[model samples]
Target: MTSDRDWTGRVGDIWATEWRRTDRSFERLAPVLNAAIVAAAGPQAGTIVDIGCGAGATSLASAQALPDGQVIGIDLSPKLIAVANHRAGSLGNVAFRCADVASAVGMHAPVDLYVSRHGVMFFADPVAAFAQLDEAAAPGAALVFSCFAERAANRWAVETVAGADDASGPTGAMTAPGPLPLPIRPMSRRC
Candidate 1:
């Protein structure tokens, strides 16, 4: 990993080895998550752009559920993108982009939905990032993302299940003050 690039881009190198080896634990959670999210979004969601779509789990689910719509998973990690592509194969109307989401919207055309799985939260300039995504989404586009209410929740879960290295920080909130003066919907509701 380059010292200059952001950690989000290097997530695969940092976590892939560990997660890829994970038995069926993640697989078991897939169906449970897919049903809840797909049902909540309803059946009308059009094209979806899955941001930070590690391994394409959510992306695949969206595509499977919305056969009429397309899904494009975007992430900064080449390895993760590759894995996602390899696993999904030619499921018509599905793509993956290995570019930084912060600047990628400018290069790509807009879509009907901007989805993310624990993505879109780690940006140095969220205002710019949100604006980019805001512009990229089609009018009335819905964003379906499943993120940790707390970043350390997953880590803590793993720690509880399997002993962790001694060097762990206390559970803390991971957020930044907004750059724009406008009110954000606290990620609980659409902005």
Candidate 2:
């Protein structure tokens, strides 16, 4: 599993340095996820939170789409947050912070929407983490996120990680906490 320690240190630094490549890796999915987020947020979303936002791409995109809304990107890595901040440049609507979203979400209470791009899987206790998010959300708030399918279904991920020497080796499948092998059931609930 990719622990918070790994993200806060080496993994985060590597991701920050390779953010361009990382973002490019998600080129196909970003548009779809962003569209879903925008659709779910609706026109009057006052505040949006991007959970585990790496370089703030989604946050920036959402901010651009909803000029009147506030977008905040939260991540566990200082390096990633720094990269996000740098990329934000003069975008006044979006901001990035380095912190654990599970614990810090309350500070941004009444969030109108929450979004993540392959980001929510890293939490040690996903239920608790999402509960925290639920606690912070405004009534009728929506959440949208994307995660890997299954290992057997993702040939690229399987092939890429086939040569791993151990479970902790370097590969998208190997490093991520809940990789392809874990089947994630779709969940929907209305509070």
- Who wins the lDDT comparison? 2
Instruction: Assess candidate 1 and give its lDDT.
Output: 0.64
Candidate 2 weakest ten by summed lDDT: 167-176
* Native-referenced Cα lDDT, model 2: 0.85
Which candidate ranks first by TM-score, i.e. highest? 2
Give the range of the ten consecutive residues with the poorest summed lDDT in model 1: 174-183
CA lDDT of every candidate: 0.64, 0.85
My TM-score estimates for the predictions, one after another, are 0.70, 0.89
**Deviation in angstroms for 15 in model 2?**
0.2
Q: Evaluate residue 66 in candidate 1 and report its C-alpha lDDT on the 0 to 100 scale.
A: 80
lDDT of 2 at 79: 94
> Which stretches in model 2 have alpha-carbon errors above 4 Å?
161-176
The sequence of per-residue lDDT tens digits that candidate 1 reaches over residues 1-191 is 12215433454666444546532456766676667657645677666787777678788888888887778888777777778888788798688888777577655555667777556655556678788888776666666665444433456644653565654633344345211212235444342
Tell me which residue pairs clash in candidate 2: 151-180
Off by over 4 Å in 1: 1-10, 14-29, 106-108, 151-191
lDDT of 2 by residue, 1-191 (tens): 68899999999999999999988998999899889988887879788999999888899999998898999999999999999999999999998989999898899988999989988878877778889999998999888888877665677876776766664435343334655535566786543
